[model samples]
Target chain A: MSRVLSSKVALGGWIISSLALAAVVVLAWASPAWAGTTTPVLRLAAEVAPHDPGAVELLATLEQPREPVSSGRVSLGGVSVSFSVRVEEFSGAPLLALGTAKTDAAGIAMLTYRPTWTGRQAFVATATNEAGTSLGSATTTFIAKSSPQSFAGTVEAVRPDGAIGQAVAGVLLSIVALIWIVLLAVVVRVNLGLGPSRAAESSGLKS
Target chain B: MSKENPSIAEDHACDLGEEVTEPGELADVRASAMRPVLETPRWWWPAVLVLGAIVVLGIVAWVVQVADGLGVAGYNDRAFWSIYEADLVAFIGVSYGGAVVSAILRITKAAWRAPLTRIAEATALVTLPVGMLFIVPHLGSPWKIWELVWPPYWNLSSPILWDFFAVSTYLLATAVFFYLPLIPDLKIAQEWLDPNRPGLRSRACRRIYKALGGNWTGSAPQRRLLHGAIGLVAIMIIPMAVSVHSVLSFAFASSSRAGYLETIFPVYFVVAALYTGVALVVLSIAACRRLWHLEAFIHSRHFVRLGFVMVAFGAVYLYLTFTEYLIDGYSGTSGNAAWVHQVLLGRYWIPFWFYFVAAGVVPIVIMAFRRTRTARGAVVASGLVVFAMWVKRLVIVIPPATEPLVRSPLSAGGVLAGNWGTYHFTWVPISITVAATAAIPLLLLVLFRFVPILPIAEMEELAGPEERAESVAVPGLSSGDGFRPAAALGGRSLAASTSPPSAMGEEGGR
Candidate 1:
């Protein structure tokens, strides 16, 4: 009976140690220091104007993996050239898209983004190769608060401006329409000419 | 007054030399031209099967590429415009060559073009569709190709949209150009089809000929109307061909890249197309002469004439290349200098030098030497010109595209793999290109099986005075001042000689 109790005590001790080890691991993962240094992270920055709130600027930098408690900056240059990055609301509705921006030598991309809503937002950057194969992706979050501005200016800026641009567009379309019309006329004329029995019966050749 | 087999007709005419003036001889000439079309050769089936297989393989490869994206075809954003783009240009350029040469000959009233006109126009007809289809593979989303023609979605400023417009219109014009000339020949082919042999294939062939021919009764009014229409279309085709290659050049020249930012690119592209087009024509003539036993028709003199034209265009292209380089290279803008250096002295040196030597120098030498001005020599010269021009197009496209725009340092992976990256061709594109190469001969071989290899009507029109004497003697012929009524060289034909017995008897009755 004494030997059995001793064996039971040993089994209880093993269980207690395993539980303690798991708890320690969970604590380490949850800690800020461990979370910051454990994996490569994405750094996001927003440059917003107080008065002209529509012109919101978004910047994304892909950070490299690091050791815990280190304050040194990691090199992210050449990691993302012509990479796609997006700014969206926390609920996943996109507010701005910087379509395929040119990355600086230092691996930072300055994107021109106009935010629609004012609240917590997320920036997601995706890297891809020339073959359109995705390499890696990262995301970061930020908050946005802007002064009231009408959406009219944004709409105006999006459209082609000036009479010259409009005139060029008009002329090009007209030419295309004319070309199609002329081609159709040629077809109809050829088909009409090919009508049966148009040639003289005496010759027996109907050309 | 009796009809003789066409096989011996031409030989008898050539042997008799201005003596075979009987009306039955005309029927004989038509029969000779249609012999290859009517009689199937033992080798034809196997050839078709082989070419068909190659075409099928290419189709399968294209399907695979579409499903997996252009990445499966070795297309990266860095190498966005590569082999297929060059192929498109080359194929389209050759078609332009065929159309322009035939048109110019017709316009100039070069009578020797009789045997060649049909083949040249048919080349344009077959190739335009092939060239146009390359755009599908070139696009990232090929299924969205309808967006090009759909009016509302058209991008007015896009070079590609204009390319679509020019090519589609050009295709329509080419088809009409090809078809209008074919009407007379089709009528003649219908006459040759033996009603006794009522096989499915023969019946189908006869029906097609009649349908295409329409009501072409070789009467004076019909001939005049047809000639007028063809003349008008011929005048229009030249400008259309010019516009096609010019717009194609704009796609490159509009870009700010070093080699592409030249003012002379439009003319350069057009001249190159002309040079290569004429050379390909010479090559096609040689192939036809051997394959269809057209030695009696397309003689050594024809090759020499075509070679002269090819050489003329080659000379101009060489001059343009020099001028294009001298101005740009002298200015020494960093981009221009870098691109020029890359092509001339860097990685692309071999192809550049090959274009200069083979397309330029060798052809000039061949044309200069009287002994090497034979048909065989011309064929060799054309072969070199065609190959070298294709390489020249690659040199034109690749160097400007790959020249560094931003000059970022090398990375482990991504578009910025180096300070400037090169377009590396993989197996996928190579296979697809090979398949395209095989398609040309395959298409031509199959096309000629249905129609006479030579244009029967044009041949009769251009035949010697001896052969045309019988044709002119028919009743109700309204011969104008420019038109000859009979083989008589003088203003008026002798009344007795004008009434050939064969013209009044058997053929007139039919």
Candidate 2:
């Protein structure tokens, strides 16, 4: 049998790619988000719209669009008044649910996109492996705001500090999605068997 | 079976003498007439399908997790991290072993690695992702895992961010290490495969053969280059595993949490990972041996060698465990001591002790002694090691988390100062983890279906000059350490190989 496979250039490619991937990883650690401290120093605070002192705006910085950030960290002696937000069509798909899982489990979920499906975005929650499936899921509809001119351009709260703030939510949402997409792409690339050999693989099959 | 002669005493002394032969001869000697053992064991595929269904269930759970708020699971103010985080870390940590085996073998220049490196490397590649996926399951908004990329302060100081870096680096590195060596293997596969074989899978082998191996003919230039690349990556991998495990340990250490703050954590995690990783290699080797019918090539002696490595790491891990408790325990530091106490004597006592005995001591005994150091013993030891390491992760994560980071006196009740909450596993996290576990062998089987199981070039290299001769009729496995006298008695000249003997003793040896 003749020796038939050459290793020079391919080996070089493997070396280069492994190095490049590692470099990217080292770069990834340079930044951090949470302060690693447990002080919980008021992440988010907002002013109440409609101006009622009792009608509080979302209190926490990390607020879900439809869920209350915190149900008034104040003692409401007797009243069990709840808070909520409107769900509307955004990118064609109507809202499906209007609630948040526990804060530590899921900070928030969903985006309101306009879709051809006509049902008024009901929180169609089905039973999971758990009971009390109906304890959550409330239908939230948005108030229809007609366009000022014949041509309807999407306009609501534009200012960062307006009656409603869009910056943080949009920014945070985008960041999460961005990580997902990018990481997913990277994961796909790795799984699909791209680029050089490094130290260890999950399985040690010497080829 | 002779009790007088004591086969048990000879179990630990498996030695390969100077049976070094030409690559071609070894290939001809061991080559199977049939095809690759790419198909999963008959039961494995259906099990994977069941696993797939469970994974779908996890997806559905994720949908609920997304639909409802994050609170639907056991997340609360106190129990911010629950089973999901532990499962993620534990699974990822386990992958550390797979990577280390390949790196150690490559670094030590262990010729036996020819048959195992790609599998180990692929395991690391797959499990790291699965471990990383735990990050998704752990996250309230897995989408925010990207925030790791652009932290506001870009605090290079944080461990979690470092974890992100370390794991990704290791995974990428392992992938390349695994693929590069296979280039020649692919070429060999491309050449020998019958034309009648169906295309898709075999086609990738042929393509990979041409594209990567690039006219490799086992020429001196090609051999030197391949060996050179493997050597470099071997050295590179140990550091990568260190970095990965260190950062992982740092994730726990960076916090002031009592259980996680020990300086010993990084080293401890690294050793534990190696220990478990070696065990996995042994198990996998045994499995491949049986499933693929490679008994002639991979003898029980190989398991013994792997068992020896497992024991070495297991001993070190035990030492670290003691040090972890001793330094912290003797100091009487309330937080550290309390956490240790809880782990050793509290609710989690059983798991902690279980891991200690199983992962730590039992394997050493079996490995050290001849009576139980056979292939069967090694398999048991390996399975124990895997289970023990998993339990050890639990022991490591939960206790410290249960202790209070900040001391707040009990509120006029016996409820204690820190309400360091305990975590419970939910179906969602459990299913996800199971799905990942099942996917491992399945994906590997699929991969081997398309790729060669052993590094063809490396095997030829290991077999050396006699490989081309194709007439060196030596059955090395039968020549146990005391085979010299036997061969002389049998009137057959036997040259036992010496490579496996020397390398088997090193914890650092692959």
Candidate 3:
């Protein structure tokens, strides 16, 4: 009776230990996916502020909600952020790359963009890790009232007046005209027998 | 000038003694000059047909290009201007030789120029138009060429506009220059024709000649007027031709591209034109001499003299090329240095060395030695020079055009290491270029059928008392029944008599 009891205890302990080992193996295999699912989601926010006459300052904040914070702010430094702008309101309109900025210690990225035309402009800021994986993105809108006057005026001023070019062209045209006249006059003279006659001279002045 | 007169060979045996007059000698000149016009050789028709067929193929290719697009010609955004531009510069550049030979020689009163002048001037007359027509193929929409001349579409700042004005003016001057000399020869050609030949071709030829030369009587006053007019036109043409090539260079130099932006391009292009121009003249003279049996008139001395001229210009062009490369390379600006590298050591090295060997070194070598300084040597050197110069123009045009002016953000390298574009020539451009080349000889052959191959009156005038006196004492130059030897003519040799002994002595023996 004692031997049978000891054997039953051994068999029970072997089965229980095997079950524990299998459980440990399964857990080890699934831990990474579970950890990935539990990772903190990144969030982004974008804001625009008028800086200069034709330029506006863009600020984008990137934050991980579950990350440890210092002084009540999420510090997401060294992450690259790209800024884009779309003047068209349609859904399929392409986003033009405005510029790129990097997040600072305060988890905020800043860029200065000069608006070319007066309209409602939609801005997008995207955050990406070193491997170029997009972490998160944000969108914002701003209405520009008066188009920059100096920009238009400056472009117009930079255009050539063509004064000297026209003068040179005029002179060349005049010279070409003079050459044509001289050539034509000579041709006419040759046709009209207006020159001295070598034949008459050779004929002993016999007309 | 009668057709019943003995063949040039038989006529050579007759002894006029010391009493041979100018009229008798001039009659021989006229007979020899008009032979090609009066008699059609067996080879003439077949050659014309072949050349014409090639030209037709070029036209078909052009049509296909117009129907499709410039893509057929391997044109793209990167290689927008390539072969046709080179062709334009080259063809136009070759015409300068004719002007230099005819006009400059006329003004300088080089009497030896008489036999070659007609060939030279006719060459200019035909080639300038052909060169101008290259603009058609160069343009993406050739039909829009009218905009170039139309006033409202004119861009005053554009070098192309000035190029048009300059080239057109030069063309008019070329036509006038060609026509003024032909008046005297036209009279001779008309006198040679049978007044009552039954065929329409004969009648038409007579009528055309009559209309062109009816007013020309070769009177003293007419000669004076013609001479004065020719002199004035000759003087005008030199500057006009210079301006045409200068404006052509300006078309490149005005651009901000690396290889093209040099201030030296104008002088460089002008010298290249003169060099290649003389080469074409040599080739023309050689062809005429060989094909028409003008060996008696056009001699080895003429070739050697023209070869000397070619080498002088070649030396200048080579110097300019060296300086252009050195300055651009030494400065080491990204664009300029990259272009220089591309030409000298990179993708274009083959053509660059080809130019260096053919145009730069070989011709100089040919001109340097007495043994190789024959008509044959001149022709060989000229063929090489013409071909090589065309390649050099390509080197000048393509490298700068294919170079990447702006750097790409995606690329790791800067502008210096930027990707260079290539112009791959398809059959369209090659056919057109070959056809244009063939048109040169084809047109010359056909042209000489209507006009005298030699300037008969000019040769007569140039054969003065000293020449007439020498011609009588010299044995008949003909050996057997064919072309005569250059040496037998002795002091009567037109080139030997006129050219400085220093220049003609080495080649005069032949």
User: Which CAPRI quality tier does the interface of model 1 achieve?
Assistant: incorrect
Better of 1 and 3 by lDDT: 3
DockQ of 1: 0.10
Scored by TM against the true chain B, the candidates give 0.84, 0.81, 0.86
Query: Taking the tens digit of each residue's C-alpha lDDT, what string does model 1 give over A60-133?
Result: 66555566336565445545533233331122444344566645656677666654433345666675444564
Q: Over the stretch B296-319, how does candidate 3's per-residue lDDT look in tens digits? A: 566566777788989999999999
Residue A46 Cα positional deviation in candidate 3, in Å, after optimal superposition: 43
Worst 10 residues of 2 chain A by lDDT: A142-151
What lDDT is obtained when candidate 3 is compared to the true structure? Answer: 0.75
Off by over 4 Å in 1: A1-197, A201-207, B1-29, B407-418, B464-510
lDDT of 3 at A32: 38
Give per-residue CA lDDT, model 2, range A1-207, as digits (tens). 133344666678899999998877776544222212211121222232343322223322222223223443322122111223423322233334323322222222222222212112222321111232222232333211111112266645323343333464456346435534543453344333423332122113332
How high is each candidate's interface RMSD, in Å? 12.2, 16.4, 12.5
True contacts kept of each: 0.23, 0.00, 0.26
Point out the higher-scoring one by TM-score: 1 or 3. Answer: 3
Instruction: Residues B5-105, candidate 1: write the lDDT tens digits.
Output: 23233322221112333443323434435666777768778877887887788788887776645655655434557778888888788888778999987
lDDT of 3 by residue, A1-207 (tens): 999999999999999999999998888667633334222243433333444655667788765555343445434788888999863322256688999998887678888876664445688888887778777777888644333334344322223437886687678899999999999888888766632354434444534
Question: Whose lDDT is greatest here?
Answer: 3
